[model samples]
Target: MITDSENMKQTNANIAEYTVSEISGALKRTVEDRFGYVRVRAELSGVKRVSSGHCYFALKDESSVLDGVMWRGNVSRLSFVPEDGLEVVCSGKLTTYAARSKYQMVVDAMEPAGAGALMALLEERKQKLASEGLFDPSRKVPIPFLPRKIGVVTSPTGAVIRDILHRLSDRFPSNVMVWPVLVQGEGAAEQVSQAIAGFNAMENGRPDLLIVARGGGSIEDLWSFNEEVVVRAVAASQIPLISAVGHETDTTLIDYAADLRAPTPTAAAEKAVPVKVDLEFSLTDLGRRLSVQKTKMLEDRKQAIVALARALPKPKDILGMNSQKLDDLSERLPMALLNSTRQKSILLGRLSGSLSSGKLQQAARFNRERLLSASSRLRPISARLLTEKKDRILVAARMLASLSYQNVLNRGFAMVKNDSGNIVKTHEGLKIGDKGEIVFASGSVAFETSSGMNEATANMPKRTSEKPRPKKPNKVNSKVDTNQGSLF
Candidate 1:
């Protein structure tokens, strides 16, 4: 806020100023109002042309000079070219150039300094175009014998159109395409050139020939037809063009560039088509002449045939041509077949040799040897695997043998059992007259337990009233309990 206030104060110290365009526009308005449409005569200087079709130059006298610019629209209307040293008259409003900050005259009208200037310019342009071969007669297109459609470049509202239509209607009466364009004044050359180009650009029933026509006029009225743009456009046209711009006395540059030149619009139409009655008569005559020529041609052909027959070979020789050809083919047939069969037989022999039994046997032997070699490599591994498995089996068998209870029996010991074949580890399970089995090393024996092995057979101990004490197992004692399954 403070900086803005400071700027405001600084701006207030100086008075308000106008932009460059604002001042220039004010000056322009003042000058145009004061010196409107003034005419000046001065020598042209520093004349330069730009691609935009505008020419910029200086209007100068001995003491001072003023800049001037003539746009394409105004430049095209001039009767003569503006040169650097040539004095000329110009008429337009004065205006200030904003960009350059200077004043200049926009020239809308220009003319030569003397009466001969126009002719000189016209001649100069003609020479230039001619030097570039624009007027070469060899480059001219031949007018078509019969054009299905004709295009005309002219004012649509003028009597020129009516006259052309009437003339063509009187003749062959073809389809006509009319291109409307301005023929004089500002932008006339542009419109005329564009109209010609438009006709050239059309397709699908495009014109066979074009006619650039206008009513009779003075050189200034017909000046558009002579512009470089219009002439070039006519020269570059794809369709054949006919120049009928003015009366017979008036000529234009387009007349030299067009394919055909006609003195008037009606004459151009007559040249573009033929009279219907005359064509019919000529066609009838042509038909009669053609029939006569055809008959004469047939007669001449008959005489030619007779003469050719006289020069031909004899009939016998002519009839034998095919037979001679057949004889030649017959002579070649057997050798050709024989050669083909020989080649096939050679191929068959070579194939048979390749498929012989010896070769098959060799292949089989090679496979068998490969199998043997593979088996030979695997033999040691298979044997080692078998040997190791057998050794494990033997070791397991030894372990199993050592774990067997029959080994104890093989030590000359027996396992005593009761009558149910239960092992009796103690003799208490057995009593006198009780039968039992004794397991030996290889067999078992059934035996009756008569008494203890070391005790009397008939002696027995009676029940006592006192508690008995445990005694040594080696001797039979009165307190021995014989109901136990252990033998100590």
Candidate 2:
């Protein structure tokens, strides 16, 4: 509301109701109240960034523009990615950047104009790619330990390229082929995949190793690396592959499908090549050991040959051994013959002694038979003669006794009898009897009379201390005590 009523200097006092500071303060308050940490829809423009990591940008379209700042903390949340030509809607607080003396909005979030719908589309694409078996582990290639040639798939101008090159050169100086491709914008995945396929098709023995790498960025900025097409290409690679993308914490399907994964481009290069200096040192050590072993073996063989030459025998020595054997046989021959003759003589003597023993045995057998015959004859003759002699002697003795009995009786011609009429055969059986009978060699007689008592009984000798009186002293007269076979 400008009026040309007074000169610019004269109208100043009339318009002194509001100061520039007060208006600015009022506007600041109004903007804060209206748009405090809110979400707004606008196109991106005038995007400028300061060294402090604070982004200054304009949210504009054909109709209007709003100034904005994204501090470091909030700047990380952007999705559609703020660029000069890109259109996005921001979510932030409308406030003043006091240090710059500027009115702006501090953006906390941003996205493409229709990100809500685009998310659905992206999810569908993800599913479609996933169903095609592009993420299968079976298709992944193996990474070679020592690669002579390496193929890099990344932006040609990014820090990733420099980092990987430096690492490869440090690890092993060798030829590396760069397969540069767009790593970020639309169709970035297709271009990257094509580049991989192209490098493979070139085949040139297919480069020993393939490195897919990129510098660190937000997930959206690095989405091309996570695409299914890129993953499938990596898996299908004939050569071994290494994936290096973003920070150590960032992961993608390409990382899973590749033969190896590294946290950074430099690490990926380091994994692909072996250190040259270390390998050379190892080779030198092995060669020295091999040479030493060969020399020792040659020395051992030479010593063996010398010992064999020293041990070899001469022809004259062999002839001397044969001559010694011949003389030994000659000295033993006469003693062997003498031993044979003595053995034969001993055998003949043993045969003669055996014949003499047989004749002596025959003579001993004849003598034994004669002795048995003599014993048989003496046994029968002696038994018969003894029986005849005993019988004759008994008969002669009986006749003689008959003739001598009368002679004896006549010499004693008297008989004695006792009181009981029994004969007094001997003086030992004599007793006084009333009757007596006497027999001589030719006659017998009986008498009754008294017999005399023995004088010893009359004396009583000590019988019971009394005289055993004879019974009236029966006196019987008897002939002399002479009997046929009795003697008094």
Candidate 3:
């Protein structure tokens, strides 16, 4: 036998040496070459998307797990959002990451494994959106009875749009605006959602109603309508929406969110508008009925008026009866008046016979005696009233004499008056050469104010006698002439 060290040296010499990177590269090449393109059926787990726009997840079953990565380009092409616990088939080539020294799948394409898986995913999504009230019946709006303009979202090149146009033409020609969009496959959901938003954002020529439709296909072909963005857009649309996405047996998330659902594209067109001919016929019929009813009502009123006129009494007969009664009263009126006058005359004659001249004289004498007696009694009262009146007059005369300004003149005072007959209370009103009157209690004398007559001389008392004797003129200038006669 060889020694242990010698054996190890010989084995090392035969084997090639490699660094960590070299071994990793060799493993990567081997994996890529062995399974160049593989299809994997597994359940998704730990699905995550980083800010780099790459999706990283793990594909696992009962036995083992495989790491998976999809670049941004591939991720954008997916029809639905990948979530954990979804069963999917991934198609890609096997590769090894040099840095981690591990094998993984670089997924280029992915889809739900079968119809069962798709149905399960759809049910799960429906439950989630329903819980958020996106599918609430109360949130849905009523479709317009007659839309003036209709907006359609579908593939422009497909039979769905052609069928809608043809059906709408047959029923009622409307303003139909077709928003062409991909209705299936990659990016179809985004296009469909954007078409809905675009219609809503229009300021002019905005449609009164919207119809999202697609031809019947497998679940995968119709999966775009089930996208959350498309479903939410349909639910939040202000314009009433009709979902005609698939056949009668096929349903989508959009069906629950839309205001109405049609079995097919043709059915949606029928619901959008009513037949023009039918509307015209209805209006004509209603107008005819109204006219007939109006005529009947007028006839009934005319008949009622005629019946009322027939039941009334004739005007000539009513007037004739009143005229006869008036004539009877006129014939009896004169006779009645003559009898009354005769009775009054008899009564007057009897009254005159009873009142004889002697009796009348007696009554007059008696009345005369009564008057003389009353006069005798009233003499003292009349004398007393006269005497009292004379006393009041005398007393009033005395009080008047006392309160008179003449009394002031009689008390050795004189009143001076201007030429205008106004009293001059102050000497300041007197000017030299101004003519005025000096009034005494007995008489008034005219005087002229001279420059030499001071206020002291003006204040002097004047002659108040009934007849004043003439005095010699003063040598000094005097305001008054001593020879002036009394004016009273």
Candidate 4:
């Protein structure tokens, strides 16, 4: 029984005899040592290479990623410095690091993630500068071709300074003043901005032109020139400016804001200076053309003077023309006077002949003869004819007096009329009881017809009922006949 109990105890102890480290070591070996290592590619991010020959960073992409490790040797061979935002294709093997107890990539090699990230960075910078109106063509200044003084703003230690100096010396050999500035750092943008502003503010006649420049670098390293403050300072500068930043493939905000943008620092310096040979040739051509123009102008003036002298009239010619006009008038005067005298003499002779013609002579003789006869016989003939006419007129007057109505009435002959007022000459026209008018030499009376004129002539006895009538004169003639006819 004792032997069996000891054996049981030994078996139990053996079954429970394992430590935590031992178990964990077995599990690690089983999980990690069996799988095949993988080589993957990703973009680099959060890159940090330490001095211990190890790099700790993330290899991530849009969908999935892992941590990465690069030994210092591999990192040193990179053509470009790795940064957080740089896209890089990494080749590495998947492995578990025992010390850190984490699965990570041990990278053997890296290359740029290709052109996509570079283009993306360029577009982002473009939009940033464009929003600030730095790319506006209107904001560009006019650079002086042959600047009197050129102001250079750049890193003192950079190759850009060397390039600019050499180009300027070669092209124009101009006087230049360099304003040193930090091209990369915390305050690098501000330093570049201040340098530009300082050159503009220089009291002793600011530089005729300015050149803001830098050498090629990575996007981050060249970012100072892309800053808004630097861009605005360049735009606000009074002097014309040239921007020489980075290589031709790289652009910054200063490029857009400057008056001129050169492909390189050397190009910017070339733009600032004029070629001495070209200027000298131009001056010579201008001088020759000016001399020809001066000669032509002198000839024009001489011709004008000669023309003016030819157009002027001489005094003697003017006097001779007037004298000829006077002589013509004098030669015609006597002929005009003689013609007028001849016309007057002819008119007088014609008038005298008309006065002595036969008709006029006959009229004169008749007037004289009639005048003498009238003077001798006019009084006696007139007196005789007047006496005879007066005697005849007296006889006719007496006959008219005897034939008038009053004279007939005085001789007792009265007129009577009928009822229609017609003269009643015979008694047959009378009507009994009709009223009638009887006219006397001096008066008239109306009577009712109770008696006739014939009765009046017949001397009828008065009727007792009739009105009384005056007695008519007895027609007894004694010696003289008083009734007479008219002498017309």
lDDT of 4 by residue, 1-488 (tens): 57988999988988856676676566566645665455465677788867685678898889877888888777655544456777777776666665666667777777666657755755776787788776788866677667788889988887888888888777778788889888875467888899998998899968899988888887666767766688788878888888888889987767777888898888888778887878889999999999999999999999999899667564345444444554464455446545644664465455556776675566555655765565456457655755665565566556555445677677666675544787767555655566565554544444555444446546745458877677764222122213322211
Scored by lDDT, model 2 comes in at 0.70
Angstrom error of the Cα, residue 91, model 2: value is 9.4
Cα lDDT of model 2 by residue, 247-354, tens digit = 898776687668788998888888888899999999999999999999999999999998995575543454445445544654664565567556654655555566
The alpha-carbon lDDT assigned to residue 486 of candidate 4 equals 20
Q: Candidate 1's residue-wise lDDT over 1-488, tens digit each? A: 56988998998889877887788889989988999888888889999988898999999999998999999988776644466676688888788888888889999888766646556667888999989988999889899988999999999999999999999999888999999998777678888899989988877778999999998886767877878999999889889999998899989999999999999999999999989999899999999999999999999999999899667664445434544554565566557656855765565556556776877566556655765675576567656755665565566556556645688789999887777867776545656666666666766655655446436322434459876555444322121224323333
Any idea what lDDT model 3 has? 0.84
Between prediction 2 and prediction 4, the one with superior lDDT is 4
Each candidate's TM vs. the true structure?
0.49, 0.40, 0.61, 0.44
Candidate 3 lDDT tens digits, 4-72: 999999999999989998889889888999999999999999999998889999999999999999999
The C-alpha stretches of model 3 lying farther than 4 A from their native spots are 1-15, 48-54, 71-79, 311-488
Model 3 superposed RMSD (Cα): 34.1
Which candidate would rank higher by TM-score, 2 or 4?
4
Supply the TM-score for candidate 1. 0.49
- Considering only N, C-alpha and C atoms within 3 Å, which residue pairs clash in candidate 3? none
Quick one: best TM-score, which candidate? 3
